[model samples]
Target: MATHHKADQPTLRSLTKRQWIRIASVVAVVGLVVAGGAATRSIYSHANAAPTAEPTAYSISDAHAASRGNARDALEGEPTYVNVTINGKTRTVLGTNFTDVKSVLDAGDITLESGDTVEPSLKTKVDESTTITISRAGAKMETEESKIPFNTVKKETSSLPKGTEKVETEGQEGILEKTNLVERSGDKIISSNTFASWVKKAPVEKVILVGTAEQQPQTTTDTSNNSSSSNSNANNNAQSASNNVGTTAPVGEMQQWAHDYLLANGGTEADFTATVYIISHESGWSVSATNPGSGAYGLPQALPGSKMASHGADWATNYQTQLKWFWDYCKSRYGSVQGAYSFWQANHWY
Candidate 1:
């Protein structure tokens, strides 16, 4: 168990220095080959590299301008639609850059004239749901013709007898023109107002004349005589004819005028006394004498007062007209004034 063993070791070789020199030479050669390979791979990688791009330049303003142009183009592509009412006529239109109602109307080629109005002001912004209205409010003068009534007037005159009337002038209607201001909205009527009215033709008034005259009372006289009075009447007629030339009248001024009137009408101076006697009995030379019993009127004591109008309208008031009528009555009834006087002498009235 107690054995001690000697450990020894030692070896010696021949030619060791020459061998080490050879191995070092071979290592150096290998290192050179590896370095050449790495250089070739770096050249290939440099040839395969891609080229870099150049940088572009622009200002903020230019960029903004380009953006706005694009925005406008987009807006033009999509137009806003709106309805327009011009004078109550409605239509639809498409408008680009539609900023206000007026712009939309202008795009639709609508024009606004003077006195034209629009609802939803021209400055109002246009939208899809917006509706524009335009009204033509031109002032126009309208005229119409109308009629005017004439007035009737009356006047009093003494030339005609009482209770008599006559037309002095004819009446004519007049013409009038009335003007109005009319307003219309399209085909519908809105308002009308009268502005001016004037007479086109003046009216003519009707004139009537009325009479006013007084009537007198009538009385009778005695003319009774015998049949031999015919010779006396003839003598009386000759005496009256001779007295007609005298300046101093035997009777009063009215009898003188009656004598002249009868002479002017158709009676001779011989009929003057007989006429005077007949008139003195009938009406006492009263021009307006009226018979109360027989309703006879005037100096002639006509059966009806209106019958005297055949001779003249003034028969009731004119002594000459009554005398002429009396002369004709005597001629027609008794053949002559002398005959009438004789009848009156027998009857008291002829």
Candidate 2:
């Protein structure tokens, strides 16, 4: 076997002084580097970590000031309040900075229907306290059926005796279909106009025959006539004349008076014709005529019968006085008889 010799391991004491000094310097440098690295990590952790100390509190006065400023700004941005009435119901709404009435209503989601009306115009400006009123109106077409009255015609016959009348034909009412345009506003009818009308049935006119024949007295020969008989016949004739005058005084007097007065007051035959037409419908040319329903009297149908007293004290019995007052009224109010007739034709009254 080869000679086994034990080699000695190097020890610190066996190492040279210069090698030991170099080893010691290396250990010192490593220690210094580890300590500096630990110190730098501590500083970086302190700089980045969240604060743990109790937070400082602001003064109550400073906090209230900031809160008040925010509240003021919010209040200034708010809109103004206004009252709005639509279809009889009132409600509150914000104006939302709108300037005109239309804009304000639009902001409230209010829509207007056809023919609706606004108290203030849509283009009118709105204020803070302005009250908007809306009138709801609508128009629609409606159809209705009505009756038309028939007319009566008169004919005179000399063959029949006086005061005798005969009906030649019967009268009948006619049917008419009328179309109306109806306008309404808030439960009230604003207007109803007849847009079209059609006659469904024609009216039958009544024909009447009047008697005008007079009876003649029988005549005898005068061979037996004596003075006493002659005197008695004259007395009888005078009594008959007086009776005729008393009976004829009230009959046909008003029509005759109206005719005479109209001719004297710068009125022509045309005026007399219109006057007769009106009087025929009003009071039938009777001075003592009185309307039971309206309390109207006289040929002109004056209301209360006292209106005719303005003419004369004898207006109740005298047809001439009533006619004079009627003529003056017609001239001053209607300018002419024809004008009055025109109005009567439209409204059924003058």
Candidate 3:
């Protein structure tokens, strides 16, 4: 009994190892629960904390400028995803390493054709918000038709009375066909120019006759008895010319006019008769008569009609003008109206 250890030391040593382990485990569990609760409280506190006041708002113009700057910054930044529209369909382009719109199009496997156009030029830098558009060719060659104006030709002649004017041929407009290279968008024409041109129908030139005939001296009727008989006798002598002349004076205004005109101009009654016959067969004395098949015109029915213009520009409408032309042609070609009539009787044309 005298050799015993200290009491405290013995007490500790008496406790079992299992018992000590159990106590330590209990303490550890309690500590974990308490720590978990404290962590949750800390999180709740931070969530409820008051936020700091926001910075003052910028002006509208300043805000716009800032937005623009941001856009510019984004465009110059790293590779981004962009949108590309060819025709009307849209698709996203993965601009992985693209720097500009052109590069973006290349990445999208898109191509441009002749006269094709793009919005936001190919040289512009691309960004996530950038959209590239491709439009089809806008220019094409087309045929166009329009009117061509006719020309007018004037000639001086003695067929009409002095100081008179007459239109021998009416003017006609012609067709002008052209090849036009036109630039258009949809239905709108932006620009155009004629590349080639041709006349579909040649224009008919208008011929005008201006008279140059000298005025005849007017005879004053002498109410005096002595001159009245003289004047009557003189008038009879003028048209009849000679009792020996074989042809009779024609009746009617136009016919009598022809008769007097021929005789006064050094023509025979036979010449007047030949003229009436040829003119009657050819045109019935109508100044505007036209031959559809041969393109002949006027009283003389001259082919191409323009030949009548040599005698008078009024050849198309004036009977006197056409008659004069006919007389001139007869004299030049057949020696006289009688000769033309002789030829016409056999050939049926003169």
Q: RMSD for each model, in Å, please? A: 54.1, 39.0, 37.4
- Model 2, span 1-350: residue lDDT tens: 79663567666668999999999999999999999999999999999999643211111112111111121121224445455665554544443366888876665445666767897899998875678887655666677876645545555555457889777669776665555557777788887644333344544546565666687575785746576886786576444432221101111445556656666867665576567555555544446543322224566655334456678988766877777777776777789766776666555566
Q: How far is candidate 1 from the true structure (C-alpha RMSD, Å)?
A: 54.1
Worst 10 residues of 1 by lDDT: 54-63
Q: Which residue runs of candidate 1 sit more than 4 Å off their true CA positions?
A: 1-250, 264-266
lDDT of predicted model 1: 0.55
Better of 1 and 2 by TM-score: 2
Angstrom error of the Cα, residue 22, model 3: value is: 99
Q: Rank order by TM-score, top first?
A: 3, 2, 1
Winning model by lDDT: 3
**What's the lDDT for all of these models?**
0.55, 0.56, 0.58
Off by over 4 Å in 2: 1-253
The candidate that achieves the highest TM-score relative to the unseen native structure: 3
Worst 10 residues of 2 by lDDT: 59-68
Query: Which regions of candidate 3 fall more than 4 Å away from where they truly are?
Result: 1-251
TM-score of 2: 0.29
